[model samples]
Structure formats: structure tokens, C-alpha cells
Target: MAKKMGIVALLLFGVYVLCMYWYIFHSGDGKIPSALQGTAADPVMFMSGKELFLSGEYSKIRNFLFFIATPFEWLIYFLILLMGVSRYFEKITTSQTKWKLLQNAGYLFLLSVFVYIVLFPLNYYRYYLSKSYGISTQTFTSWMKDGVLDFWVSFGMSLIIVTVIYWLMKKSEKRWWLYTWLLTIPFTIFVMFIQPVVIDPLYNDFYPLKNKELETKILSLATQANIPAEHVYEVNMAEKTNALNAYVTGIGSNSRIVLWDTTLNRLTDNEILFIMAHEMGHYVEKHIYFGIAGYLLLTLLGLWLTNKAMRPMIARYGQVLKINKISNIRSYPLFLLLTSILLFASDPVSNYISRYQETRADQYAITLMEDREAAVTAFQKLTISGLSEVNPPLLVKWFRYTHPPMLERIYKVADHEGQKQEIPLKEEQKK
Candidate 1:
């Protein structure tokens, strides 16, 4: 049973989860938007034959479309249709440096736009699902604005990397993948260092957590965890969502723990502290830097694999898709599509590493707090508030879940032998 759930969740829900994080690239925000906010019923009402919206029964089917079916559509569209378009575009650009580079940018832009068009339905359905779940609060106009902004950000960043990658391929021919892999390590680190300060603020408002009292408790936890104390932030997501989340983003001086304002409002002080400590565990464990290393390493492997496979794949499908050279601007989509397919195949490996890290953090939180009951209670609240799947099959756990199920967390926290320490948060905040 556990293995079944894990497999289903990994192949199906895992894909959706990947796309879910890809959007905001973090957990959601929640603050009461309009007076109607948080008061509105779920937009997706249960059918007569279905269980209640929050009963966990609806999760299997609802998630089937969001996490599984729709994502496949986009994947196919990119791999098959877009690759065809890319090859067609490549036929026109002459192999001159200035013109070819110029054409590469132009072709890349067209591919992005086309991919966006093909993927929009899935994206909209994602928004619809969030609204249905009563998680999203933004108006349609606002949602569209964010979507556009997200696209432009992706396009601009991808353009820079794709252009450089293809240029290296043009120059090195045989070893371009190695050079590109080398470039991404420093590039990835630079992005991690700057993302919190530069990119996150563009979509949502962030302020120092509003409750000074709770802020003090978080700082104390940080001290216990030996993490920096100054930079806890509250994201203004109340206007856009009711989902509760907190995550550690950025690195070094730029590193900070960001909490959804909704989390602060909805969860108890004990719960919030546990969540923060879990995040602090990441820093204490140096998981972020390690994660970067792991990703760059995988990317290196993926690039090498793609290079090996490209000749045969293009030979088999090239005439059909319309391109000749691997480095052709139009053939770039095939490169991307193939690499993504490779990564998708290996998600289980990546997610397994993530789950271990998250469990370590959970253990850290429980031990540091020395409050087993609070830890269990915190997991319960997190599951209830987020409507998380509590007993996902082992497959899902292996591939889709970054953290263990709430049920597993409860047992782990309960079973661990740790010291008892009295701390603040005996009385809950009024909110």
C-alpha cells in the first residue's frame, strides 16, 4: 500500500508538485484580501458521488488532472510540437556569428511564446484549482498579471543562458556540455545569493513579521539553532492565497526565513516555532548549498546524457522535426525537451534526497524544542491547514514528497528521545 501510494504520487502528484513550486517557487501567501476573502466557499464543490472537499478523498482525482494529466500535455507539446517548430525556425538563420546569434535570440523568444501559449491552459487550470481549493484570493486580472510577469522573468533569464550555451556548443562542438555545466555552478550560486533580495519582492509584499512578540520567539529559536536572527520576513499573500507555508531562501547575508502571513495568523506560536526550527535545520545542516551542488552535479550528468543521445534522437526525428545540427537555434528546444525528460525520469532520486533532508530537519526541530507534544501538534495543524496528504503511498513519498507525510512526522517526533526544555509560547496569541 505504501509503495503504491508513493508510485502514484511520484509519477502523478510529483509532476504537479514540481509545477506548483515552479510558479511562485515557494509556498503560498494568505491574508484576507477583500471582505469576502477566507469567507468564500471552495470554488470546486464536491459532486454527489464524491467526498467532502477537504476529506482527502477528493485529492486522488483532483490531483490526477493537476499533477498528472495536464503536465503531460505540456511535456508532450514541448517535446513533439515545439521541437518541430524549433527546427523550422533553424532553417532560416544563416550560420554567421552575428546573424546566427541574433537569430538565436529571436528563435528562443518565439519558442518561449509558443511554449507559453501551449502551456497556458495547464497554468490556468492550476489557478482554477487553487481558487477551487479556496487558496487563491487574487482577482483574475491580478493573476494574469503575475502570470505574465513570471513568463517574462523566465524568458529573460533563459535567454541569457540558452544563448551562451549554444554559443559554447558552436565553439567547442565536442566539449560544450562540460563548459556549460561548469558555468551553471557559479551561476546557480549567484542566483541563490540574489534571488531573495531581487526576485521575490517583484510579486508579493514582504515586511518584517508583524507580531513583535512572535518575532521574538522566532529569534530565540534561531539562537538555539545557531542561525542568524535578524531576517525573518512575512510575505503578503493573504490577498492572493490562504495556504500556509514558511521556507528558508537565499544564502549568507541574503539568507532569511520567510513566513506566509497566513501561517502567522492561523497557526499557534508553538506550531510556528516548530516550522521555523525546521527551516533553521536547513541552514544548520547547510542543505541549501548542498542542494546547489547536487543540482549542478545532476545537470552535468544530464547534459552529458543529452549530448550522447542527441545524435541518434535527431537522426531518428531530425528530418521529421526539421533540423540538422545539435547547436542549431531551432534544435535548442529538442535539447531542452530531452534534458527535461531525463530530469523527470530521475525525480525519484532527487526527491529521496529531499525527504531525508526534511526528516533531518524535523528531528532537529523536535530535539531542539524538546517538546514532542508540540511537534506532533504542529504537524497535525500543518496537515489540516494545508490539507496535505497524510499517508501518501511510498512511490509518492519517494518521488513527489519533499517531506515525510504528517502521520510519519507525528510518529517520528513522538518516538525520538530528547531533552525537555521549557520555552515561551505557553499561551496562544489572539491574532
Candidate 2:
């Protein structure tokens, strides 16, 4: 049985590599011809001064290693390794316990620690690479502090999630998938709503933008974009990273734009305005709500597919793997493996949706701010500050990029005539 499992694993690994190659390359040009005013033929020229800083061999090596971690490979090996540990744990814990739920939580915590150990080298190297490349400012101690906090938070969440999931599975053998997925929708929405406010503050300091003049300038752009934001925030990302970013998150009253301090200190005023306008575009277009809806649907389908796939595999491998049932705590490694495989399969579709939304937001920002030159210039700064590839391999972009390349963005701005600014909505008019 173990030998057969090995053969199956080898075959699956081959399929994964081949699928990654074919599915990524054959995906399409991903050009958005429908939404934008016009497609630009040329990308914005990168700044000559920062050429070596961003495109140098050092940056290339880091970027290469970064994407390599993302192909869902590490989790597969972890899944295999943890199966041995899972069986050992199941055997040890089987000695009658009154606190079954507590025992299960301990099992999860044990597994989480094992996963942390397995992946720690990659995690630590990423931090080291950041510091070596002059992108990280946080001390190693501070970085480890953040990591430990993240681990505890994940462990806590997993304890609750696993407890409920297994409870459902035990109650109804077949209907658990439906029930679990239905429960997941709300759980996800709640997490998204709270993350910007709750989870984010744990890692970084976020304050209202200290520069009143800049805050007022951003307010003007928000007014133009119809974002009902009452505050503009600056996260003290200068303490941790040199990368520049601004994003809009949360729902209703929680919604706001957060600019990294690095961006505030590094970009020109015109560039900042364009960046804020881009984030505001996301707010006005209701991308957050739409994203939640899209994810809910995708998750529902994903969980269903996982359930279908696992049934056959468990029938064949369950005894050898020591998983007595779907609800068995020992089966989590298998569940994780199947889910990771499904997520990797779904990446091309998810990324395509993300790219279109991002492209539209860029166009919207250009038109709303009415600054074509700034749009081009801002992307150039972003490419340098972020060390973005001007035009990555088509396959890599298809599988990974949520936004269009710097070359595509700059050229698009050049081609676009810009959208006419719409009148502000009535709700803001009363205020």
C-alpha cells in the first residue's frame, strides 16, 4: 500500500508540473480589450538612475526564489512528512481521554508547529533576502516577534475551525461539505471585515496621515473618486520594508485607504495623488464586496471538488494512511494536500479576474485624476521601488500576477484618452 501511494504521488507530481506549464502558457495574452479606452503599444520607460537597483542580478535572484516558493510545492512535502507524525500522534492519543475536543486542538497545535518547522527555513531566508537587498528595516528580533504572534493567531483560528469542521463531518457523513462551505462564507466575510482593523494593528502602527496638507490633497482625490472615506492612514511600514504600496480595505465605516510610510516619503506629490486615485478606484467600484462574492462561490465549488476527490483517494489509501474517517483528526494532512492541489488548479482563473479588476482601476485612476503623465511616472516609480519585472514570462504572469506588468500599465496610460469624471454621489453631497 505504501509503495502504491509512492507511485501515485510520483504520477501526481508529474501532472502538477505539466499542468503548470501548459495551463500557465496556454492561458491567453490576458489583454483587456473591453474595458479600457485604448491599449498602449509602449511601456513607460524605467528611470535610468535606478536601473541597477531594481533590475540587477541581486533583485532577480530574490524575485526568482520568491515565486518558486509559491508553486504549492512546499506544502506537498510537508503533507507527506506530517502523515508519519499524524499516525504516531493518533496512536499515542488513542489512550482514552475525557477531553476529546481539547485533545484534537492539541493535535492541531502539534501539526502547526511541525509545519512551522518545515517552512521556517524559507520564511527566514525571505527575511534575510529582504535585509540583504536593502528592503527590510526590521531587526531580526522584531521579525521573529511578528512571526510568533502570527503563529499563535493561526493556531487559535485553526483550533476553532477544525473543531467545527470535524464536528460537522461526524454529524453527517455526506452533508458536511455543504454545511461546512455554507459556514465558511460568513466566516470569511467576518475575517475580511475585521482584518484591516483587528489583525493589521497587531503587526504595524497605523495612524491618520500626519501631514495635513497631504491628507487634504488625498481627500480631494477621494472626493473625485466618490469614496466616502473619512480618514487617510499611513502605516509605519518604514520600520519593516522599503516597498511602497497603498490599498483600500474594509466595508462601509471600516473602509479607508492605507498608504505605506515608504510611499509617503519616497514618491512625488503627483505620484502620490495618482496612487491614491488608483486605490479609490477600487473603493468606488465595490471591488471588496465583489471579491467576497466571487470568493464565496469559488470556495463553495472548491470544497465540493475536494470532497469528491478525497472520497476515492481515502477509499484506497485511508487504511494505510491511518485515517479512519473524514472527521478523524489524523486526516487533516490529506485534507490539506487535496485543498492545496485544488487551489493551485484554481490560480489561473482567480488571477485572471484579479488582473482585469486591477487594469480597470488603473484606467479609472488615470481618468479620474486626469493626469496621464503622473500615471506613467507613478508606475515607473513603483517598478523601481518594488523591483517589479517590466514584462515577466507570460506563464509566470498568468499564474501569479494580480496586476498587469509595469510595461503594460505604462503603455495603457499612454493609449488611453481618459474617462470623464462622474458627478459625486448624493450621499456625500449632503455631508
Candidate 3:
């Protein structure tokens, strides 16, 4: 049975790898078409920037295909974690007590530390690459602090959630997936609410939009757009990265617009207003609800399918984990790892849905803001600020990026003919 389970696990692992590879190499051009407009083009129009490759106009991207294959590297690291967790669970065969829990947690922590060590190089590049391009404000020490803080926060959260999920899974047996998902909705809501209030404060300082002029303008934009927002705030993003960003989150009274300090410092008041208006458009268009609903549906389907497919494998490999009690913390890591692996393996499908939603928000932004040039400039600035590939490979863009490339967004905004404005640099005034 162990031999059979091993063979099946190896086969499944192979399938996972092949699927990831196929997703990267064979996926369609992941950019929207130049001629496309509105929500019609959204949902699957991430085929624009790749028309160059689709037309076979660029061989450069082909040569750099290996660079696009690195998300698979993330997969391998996660699989190692899965194996470690499985090993810990197997060690729990003799006893399932308080001491066992401590042992497993200790092992998981050590494994996590090991993964962090392995991830340090790539993680360094992810940040330094941004800095090398003049996009990051993260000092090395600050980066290390943030990394450790984030990891522990994540680890703690996952520990609790995975424990609960596994407990539910065992308690409900065959109906575990359904019950766990129902529980997850409320869990998700609680997390989302606390995230801005609790989690965000850990990373960035948040203050009410204290500038009356900017505050008034933002309020006015919300009023004009009928976006139903009362709170607007600015986050101290300067502590981390120099890039600009803004977003509206939550619903009704919980809804608020957050501006990165860099964004406020960089964009003109009018441009800022326009950007805020675009964020308001998302709320106005009910994009948040759309996102939430879509997420739930996808999650439901994903859980159902994964549960169905994994049950047999669980029976086969479940013994290797010695997980008699679903509540065992020892089982949490491996299950979470497998769950993440499955989700990561399904990136293409997930990306497809996400790309659609983003395209809708883009259109919503255009219609809401009615300021084409600001949108275009925003895209351009973001691209430059983040060192984004103006035209990335279809597979890379799809499997990796949530937003359409900056060039494509800029082109769309330009094509729409928004009023252009010259933005004065804050630094230039000091000079």
C-alpha cells in the first residue's frame, strides 16, 4: 500500500509540474487587444500585449522563456514544506498529546526557518530588483524586520486556521468540505475586517487624510460619483517602497480609500482626485461584491473538486502522516501545503477569472474618472516605478501579474483621449 501510495504521489507530483510548465509555455497571448473596450473585453482579453508574440514578431521573449519559469521554483519549495509536515505527522504515530503538539510546532518552525533561508536569495532579488530600478524604499534591516514580522503573522494565522479546518474536516468526515467552506466565509469576513484595522497597522502607519484640500476633493469625488464612502486615509508607504498606489476596500460604512504616501507626493491633486475617482468607480460598479461573490463561488468549486480528487490519495498517503485525529496540528502543515500546491497548480484558471475582474475595474475606472490622461500617466508611472515589463510573456503575465501591463493600460487611456496635464515634482520645488 505504501509503495502504491508513493507511486501515485509521484505521479500526481509529475502532473502538477507538467501542468505548471504547460501553463507557462502554451497559454494564449495574455494581453488585451488594442481595439478592445469596456467590460466586453474584460474576463479574458489579457491577450493584447502578446499580439507581438502572437504575430511572431518577437523572438526575444522566446529566448527569455526560462526567466518566466521561476514560479515553478516557488512550487518546489512548497513541496518540500509539504514533505516536512508529512514527516512530522508520521512521527506522531505513537502519541497524540500536548507534548506531540509542541514537537510538531517546533519542527514546523524549524522547517519554516529553513524555507526562509532558502527563500532569502530570491526574496532579496524581489525587493532589491525593485530598488535597483529606483522603486523600493526598503532598507535592508527594515526589509528583514518586515519579512520576519510578516512570516510570523502568517504562520500564526495559518496555524489557527489550518487547525480549525482540519478539525472540521475530520469531525464532518465526508461533509467536511461543505461545512468548512461555510465556516470559511465568516472566517474570511472576520479576517478582512481585522486585516485593515490590525494587520495593516503592523506594516504601515495609517492616518486620516489630514490635508483638508485633498480630503475635500476626495469627499467631493465620492459624492459626485455617489460612491457611499465617508473615510479616506493615507498610509505611510514611504517606510517600505517608493511606488505609488491607491485602493478602495470594504463596503458601506466600512469602505475607505487608502493612498500610499508616495502616490500622494508624486501625483498632482487633480490626478490624485482622478485616481480616487477611479477607485470610487470600483465601489460604484459594485466590483467589491463581484469580487467577493466570485471568490466564494470559485472557492466552493475548488474545495469540492480538491476534496473529491484528494480523498483517495488521502486514504493512501494519509497513513504516512499518522493523522488519526484531524485536529492534530501535525496534520495542518501538510494539508495546508497540499491545499496551496493544488491552488498554485490551478493558477491558470484562477488568473483567468482574476484577469476578467481587473479588466472590468479598468473600464469602470475609465468611465468613472473620465480623465484619460491621468489614467495613462498613472499607468506609465506605475510601470516605471515598479520596473514592470511593458510587454511580458503571455504565460508570465497570466500566471503572475494581476493587472494588465502598464504600457497596455497607458495605450488604452491614450487611445481614449484623456486631457493631459503636466505634473510638477515635489522634489523639483525644493530644488
Candidate 4:
């Protein structure tokens, strides 16, 4: 049964890859609306003809990579269990230590290393693609350094979380899922609280925005939004990538308004202000809190489902998979495999909710800034810098888009400006 399931998983992955390749590469780029095109002096053009082609190709390849990576991750976990690699690691760890904590750590370290090695090729290809497309500026050595740092950080966190989860399972097999879910609420918050101050500094240097004039303007905007930001922070991302970005991160006192140096160097002051306003809108609307709440709810559902599904699967295929029970450390791969499948299944629903929140943030920014021209042009520049598809395929949009498509965003802002202009013209006619 294990062999059959693994084969089926491989076949399904192959079929999906082939279909996605044809769908993404064979399909033509989305056309720009004729009316939306303005001249160089009053430009609304998001991309030139050459840029449109390049962005389309780049976007398609990126979407292909993203769509494949999730299923591939599931397959990796499934194979680890099906092939008894998890059991092998379990045995080695058990032989090495009598303490359960030490054993668990040893097993997880081996698993993490194995998975990293297997996935490194694909990860490197992603970096290579970005470099070839003139997106990534980092050298291979620098990229590898960051990747290693990421792996260690992730492994450390997972070790802690997994140890607690297994401890809960040992305490109460039936109620472990509920207890874990409850624990995750505080754990998730703690991670978010510390992430900005602790984890982020590992990758790049962050400091107060050096342009005091621009920083003052941003702080003023933050004040208007009622965000208690003491300073606008900038990260040195120009050394790594050419992409322009800004975001609001963390909660309460840890919350930070961060801009990539790439963005500051590339965009005008008004454009930067519009982007800052958009990020501020996220806080003003309390989207972060809402996001956290939504995540917890989904996690609760996922954990419950995983518990329900895992028991039956173990009863049927425990012998074949070499996992005797849920509490057994050998079952770790099965647990992760089930959770990953659930997460993959929930991607569309989660992405939809995310897009809605993002749209609301955009609307808030537009209303707060009241500068439609800046908003539209800023989005255009962002699309160019990122080589983003202005209008992606429906499947890609549904599965991957956390924000609205660039074309949709620009059009909305342009239409809002038109309506505002028409209101005054109608008042004059009535007078």
C-alpha cells in the first residue's frame, strides 16, 4: 500500500507539472487596455512592450515554481515515511540517546538535513532564475549563506514546536490536537513579536531611515493613521535584490514600518508616501489582528482534521509505513505529511481571505492619501521592478495571489480619480 501510494503521488505530481508548464508557458500574456495607455508625459503604462514580454515570462516561471513546490514538499514527506527513512532515523536516534528529548532532537536534525539536501537543487534553481532575470543581485556565496541561516532558524523553531507537540500527544492521545492548537495561539504571537527584533536582523542590517526629511513625512502619515511609530526603518536589501518593497510587521511595541533601501532609491517621495500609506492602512484597519485570528481558526480546523485522519491511516497502514502509533517518533513524517496536505488544500480559501484584506488596505490608503496619481504610478513602478504579471491566470490568481493583480489595482485607483473629477463637473453643470 505504501509503495502504491508513493507511485500514485509521483504520477500525480508529474501530470500536474506537465499541465502547469503548458498552461503557464503556452498561454499568451494578458493584453493592456488601449484606453489605459497614456503618453510618456502623462504615463499610465505599467510596462513597455519588451517589459510586458519579459514580465510575462518571468511571472509564469515564478508561478510554475511556486505551484510545484508545495506538492513536491508533500511528496518528499510522504516518501520519507513510505520508504522507512523516518524509521531508520528513529532507530539511529534511539540508539544514540536514552532521553526522549535528545532522541527527538537527533531524529529531527537528521530529517531536517536530509530534506534540505533533497530540496537544495530546486532552491538553487530558483536563485539562478532570479539571477538570470536580473532580479537577484547577490552572489552564489551570499545566497548560500542566507539559505543556510534560514535552514538553521527554521530547524531550531521546528525542533522546539515538535518537541512540545509530541509531549502533548504523550499526555493525551485523543485531546492532543486541541491542546496543541491552544498552545499555538500564544506561540504564534510570541514568534511574531520576536521576529522583527530577533530573526530579521540575522539576514540584513536595519537602521532608522537616514533621510530625516522623508522619515518626518512618514512619521506624520503614521501619526495621522494613529500608529505609534517612533521612526521609519530601512533595510539594506539593495545588496541582495533589486526589488522594491515596504511593509508593516510585528504587533504592539514590536511593530515596525520597514522599507527596503531599493524602494527609497528607486521611487519619488510622493510614491514612497503612497506605499507607506498602504502599509499604514494595514495597521489602521487592524488587519494584522484579523489575520492572526483567521490563521488560528484555520489551524484549529486543520489540526482537528489531521487528528481525525491520522488515526485511521495508522490503523490501516501503520505496519507498511513502520509507524506504530501517533505518539511514536517514527510517525513524525506522517503527521507533517497530513498537515501539509491540509494546508495545500486550504490555499485557495486562505488566499481569497488575504486578497480581501489587501484590497481593503489599498482602499484605506487611497482614501487616506487622496492621491490617485501617486497610487497608480507607484503600483506601475512596483510591477516593473518586480517583473510581476499585471493580470495572472485564474488558477495562479486563486491559489497564489494574496493581493489583487496589478492591473486591477491601477484601474481601481484611476477610476476612483475619474469619479471624483466627474462629481465636480456635475456640480458645475447643475449650477
Highest-lDDT candidate: 4
Query: Deviation in angstroms for 291 in model 3?
Result: 1.6
TM-score winner between candidates 1 and 2: 2
lDDT of 4 by residue, 23-142 (tens): 878866455556544421122243566666688788888999998898888889889988999999999999998998899899999999999999999999999999988889999999
**CA shift of 57, model 4, Å:** 0.9
Ranking by lDDT: 4, 2, 1, 3
Candidate 1: residue 282 lDDT (0-100): 89
Please give the CA lDDT of all the candidate structures. Answer: 0.70, 0.73, 0.62, 0.86
Better model by TM-score, 2 or 4? 4
Q: For candidate 3, lDDT tens digit of each residue in 1-431?
A: 54555466567666766765565456544454555433221211222333323323222333233343343344443345335544554455424445544554554565567667766776786677556545577899988889989889977875566556666776776787788789778777777667777787898788898788889878887888776566689998887786789987655455668999888888887678777876776677777777777777777877777677556655665665454444444455445555665666667776776666666667776776787667666665654455455555665665566666554665555554322223222242224
TM-score of each prediction? 0.80, 0.85, 0.75, 0.93
RMSD of candidate 2 to the true fold?
7.9
Question: Considering only N, C-alpha and C atoms within 3 Å, which residue pairs clash in candidate 4?
Answer: none
The digit string of per-residue lDDT tens for model 2 on 1-431 reads 66666677667756766665543345444333354322332222233434444454444455456455554454454345334778666556566455878777778777788778877998898899778767788899999999999999998888888888888888986888899988998898788888889988999988999989988999988877666667899999888887889998877677768999999998888889999988888887888898989888888888898788767877876777766678787887777777776777787888899889998899788888788777776776777676666666666677668888776777778635532121111242234
The better-scoring model by TM-score among 3 and 4 is 4
Error of 3 at 195 (Å): 1.5
Query: Where does candidate 2 stray beyond 4 Å?
Result: 7-44, 49-83, 93-96, 415-431
| Candidate achieving higher TM-score, 2 or 3 | 2
* TM-score result, candidate 2: 0.85
Would you list the clashing residue pairs of candidate 2?
Answer: none
Q: How well is each residue in 1-431 modelled by candidate 1, as lDDT tens digits? A: 33443355357646666765443222222211242211111111111112233535334534444445444643554444333656555544444345655776677766777778877887788788768766578889999989988988898888889888888988987899999998998899888999998999989987898899999998998887776678589998888887688999998788889999888888789888888888988889999988988998899999999888877876775665566777766677667767877876788899889989999998888788877667766665565555666555444456567777665566577643331122122222112
Cα deviation at 311, candidate 4, in Å, is: 0.6
